[model samples]
Target: MTGEEGLRACDLTLAGLLHLLLRSSHHSSSKLTIFAAQQAPPAPGSRRQRHPRDAKLSTATPSYIYIPTTITKPSATLPSTDDTDTHYRELDLPSFFNQIPSITMDHRPQAWGRPRDDVYGAYNASYMNPNGPNQATQAPIVTGTSVIAIKFKEGVVIAADNLASYGSLARFTDVKRLRKFADSTVVGFGGDVSDMQFLDRHLQSLDIEESYDLSTDQAPRLNAANLHKYLSKLMYKRRSDFDPLWNHLLVAGLDDAGKPFLAAADLLGTTFTSPSLATGFGSALAQPIMRRYVPDDEAAANLTKEKAIEVIKECMKVLFYRDARSLDSYSIAVVTKDGVDLKENEKLEKQSWKFAERIRGYGTQVV
Candidate 1:
């Protein structure tokens, strides 16, 4: 029909026109059926074929229902809702992901986003304590004991034990407490092993920096005395800030003037220089022995290298029998005008406890 005839046909109302516009815009496969109050019913025994959308209405009455021709089937990649295996497989992905350990802090309790149970629960790692304080290690755990050094005719001799005690128990037996810095200076540490490692790395960085600067013609490099002064200032700064590095350090080498240099700096930043120095328990036990050999600068100037080494070995032997924190294996360094002679894994002569067998009233010993 033409446009004007269709617009005027059957006296169409506003609602009817709106309904026609909506139905016409729908999919082409959908048929529109209209039921009016004035329309007559079909004759008896004459079955009228109904559209699929209108089949649900009662035969004695007239009605209409719109059914879209396009079916919303699930995508080919998506599993059917009725398949239990598909659902199980999809759920297994998360379990697999959770089972995979993460290097980051993502598997924490709050980040897990799942209920706690024995199978998949909170991560319990020794290094991770969720509710604990966020503070660095301020106290020493494993530590080494005394570092003794003395100045003699040729250069300075330094010694320290290889023992690293866990609290009061001698746990690690092979920890070298002596560090050689820049091939000319030997630093003997006598406290917290962690802080010693930190300082060792710092000295390594300094060595690297100095090596890089060797391309230029420098007048003089850092000597043992200069290193001692630098360490004294560093310790003092840390002490003033109430965060001192828990270590007593002995810096021993030849000075810029090629004289035997021996100096000490403690955690309190106290600096002391003499012919002899001893840190930790050695200050009380080994100091006298060292002084007897090199009592003054003049005596140290006259002391021979052989006599100086004999004195240090005697002191170490006494410390091994007397000092509870001392070990038989020690690291000894002799810094001279030639270079540093470091013997890191030096073991003392075989010792015996046979004398203790004669002691009375100890470990069921007969009187």
Candidate 2:
């Protein structure tokens, strides 16, 4: 056969195979009949006989069907009214909408599941004020009133009441504000009690670090002066960040040279050293009494430890009478060359209001 006839045969064979494949495939829906070059009819009486399969292939028209590439998913059927009723009955509709909606006209969103105001009281929304500046501690709450201290020849004597007041209320009576650092230093804290706790924990960690260094290098522990500097820097850093620790701290101990050391650091990181130092109401109430004895560095140098303790006790007594936040019970510490002599629970002696009974205008007294 000629090359042209072979090409025509190849085309016809390909079309026939495609038609068979399309017919067998279940996906094909649209049929495309392709008419290839038909074979010439045999001459009359040519004596050529065709096979039955070839005859069938010649008689049948070859076509290509287009099948969609995507498979169609079965459509979902709607539930009958009876089934729908059963489902509705099974659902917990009340639980689904259990939260009480807010009736206020304001656009602010409600805390839906919170207890009603009549039962659990209204929630504090002061912290949620969007217009307020983002800041730490607008003012201190649950505070200590005063910390009083006096310097002497040997060391420093400092005292603070054990009472932590919640505004005007004496909430906690057994909270000691005096913390001893290492063996030599005693720190007296006055101001926010919560901030005091934070500083206390921070100091404890610092003490641990100092202890490790002391063990390794056999170096002397940090003295009162060093600790005071560290605390002042920490306070100043926090203040710079606008998150100052609301505390007035008085550090008392022997200096690095084994001399007496006493200094004060406030929330703003202000530092000052004096023969007599007091914070809060102590600055107004107890300072006069302490300064009467140890007024200057010269007097402090001449003053004995016994004389200092006596003066501190007298100041404490004065504060107990004058300062409303002051308490009869207090914690006092005397830091000297030897170690810290601390008494966490000390009471005023012979404290009484019996004298007021004799006055004419006293309680239940007739004018």
Candidate 3:
């Protein structure tokens, strides 16, 4: 029943009705009482007759937090009709919306200041079927932006600026969405942060020997390079099937055979391998810089760890200066056949507006 109808039928004020309701239900619950193994029921005529279904339970621990359970969290029910139908019945469970008969709007548009909103559209009811065919998300909602990866001599270094934007909002920074798969694969994510998360969970389920329904050897092991190749294939297959991962991923690591490996996969399921790879704006600005260091088979074969690293750093600085979405601070990860080493907070040195002061147009320098 609506509170007003209940109060008028009982001939009580609002406050009085609420107080009585609380007192009755709170006393009846016996929430804090400690009971022994067996307890006796009161006689049929007794004021507080015990329910036969109630069972004694152990009270090893009691919560002290007082969370309101009545008005604050009440079961849904049919509204009280009028002053004549005043008595309230506590529902054993919430009434299902479908079970309620057709409810017509009353004369009062809205009791409080709430909007009297009505939805008028045909609702498709078959979506809940267990045997329903598979469906994919229509469009990405939350998404990561750019992921850039470069190869060095000792290993591969991949970095992604932590930005999960909602369309143009740039909503979430510090969303470290990049994940390392196994030994050799560091999956750097760009585009659709939620899709990245969904893929993360999906990958977590892939190596079944670790997660579920398996009984055998278990180890602190990952296979990121292998995982990367699989993802490339998966992305392309999904695109072919008319669904896509909606993420641009850069996988940096060594192949199973211990060769330096860096590859990328995109929403269209396109795949490419290089000494360095980037997605989004980085693709245009950073690729040429990386290619200078690892330009061809001859260059990549001769790439020393220090030179490779220097080239990557130079590329990052260029990206920071060029890509509006790029940041001075980023996460860098190195993966080799040995292991994966990731640095979440690496900042650029000497990045300041002091350079602007020395430039031609600080105030009115160009004369």
Candidate 4:
């Protein structure tokens, strides 16, 4: 054939093949029929000639009908009412709905966590879980705000307000942040109350061990400097393990040489020592006030006990007035050669908001 005639013949063959494939795919019948390439129609009485590969290709084509995949048949039982009055129980709607069985009905032996209510026993909610591992809380829910401390000629004095805020809500009002480590040492904590409690227990254990160990007198007990070092190491260790204790701690007491020692340590294990130290909002609000009285180590040495107490009280007063997280009630501790004198229930005297009445542009007050 010439080039144009050959091209026309190829086009006709392709069109016929595509038409056959489309019809087989969309038609109602599931069976697919594939035709061998057709030549001009054979002579009327002549037997049709077939390619040698036609029989093999026909055998290779699938004989089974193709059925598209579908979702499984639903087997839901429907409610039926009998027309004939044969023996059949009537449906009790109220009983069917109200008398539903409990999921833990067959669990006997008190279930460890829950008690059998029918036997005069109440469900115990005190236990969290009976059969599984529990998780430790890594988040601080209720937290305290700040702790402030300063050194004087006699020794160191530390103070912290008695307020534990639940997020922004002022929830607890009487939490004492000042903890007496021993007769001489005092530790003030500012951060998560739960974490503070854990550290308090730990310090209590340490104190007990020190008290029992008879060699404490000959060897040296943990002074303020030693305690600060130990705590800094602990904080850094926890931070390295990626589970840091969420707190800022102030260690205050007399050193081995009978000199006052005060230091601060934070969650990241950072430690700083000076005549004065504060944590949380106290670092911002109260530190400046305390620094005014004892600006440096020389000033702290000259500062008397009464003056130090007065300065700390003034700091606490300023915190209550300025810091939103602070409260009037607070705990104060003075560490001296004599011993640690801690008073937890001290309240700020003359703490009042009545001064706002005279402020202009507030309520009905004229500007």
Candidate number with greatest TM-score: 4
Whichever of 1 and 4 has more TM-score, that candidate is 4
- Over 83-151, each residue of candidate 2 has an lDDT whose tens digit, in order, gives 111110111123212222453432212454565565667778897789997547658879998999999
Candidate 3 lDDT over 1-367, as tens digits, reads 3322322333224234334544655645423221221323233454322223343233222211111112221323423223222122222211212222344422221223222235334434487677965457557777765677776666777877766767766677688867866444678888877678878888767755444533445534445566676788888888888877788888877765677777888877777887778788888988877877777655776777667666666677777776766666777777766788887777776555555667776687884
lDDT of 1 by residue, 1-367 (tens): 2212222332334324334444564523223332221112334454321123232322321121221111133535433433221110001123323444444445433456443445566655655767876334378888999899988899999999899999999999999888888889999998989888889999999988877777767646888999999999998988888778999999999887999999999998999999999998899999999999888999999998888988898889888988998999999999999999999998777566676677787588767
Candidate of highest lDDT = 2
Q: Can you give the lDDT of residue 188 in candidate 2?
A: 93
RMSD of 1: 19.3
Worst 10 residues of 2 by lDDT: 83-92
Question: 258, model 4: CA deviation in Å?
Answer: 1.5
Query: How far does residue 367 in candidate 4 sit from its true spot (Å)?
Result: 6.1
Better of 1 and 3 by TM-score: 1
**TM-score attained by model 4:** 0.62
Per-prediction backbone clash count: 0, 0, 11, 0
At residue 330, what lDDT does model 3 achieve? 73
Query: Would you give me the overall lDDT of model 4?
Result: 0.72
Off by over 4 Å in 1: 1-137, 350-367
lDDT accuracy of residue 165 in candidate 1: 96
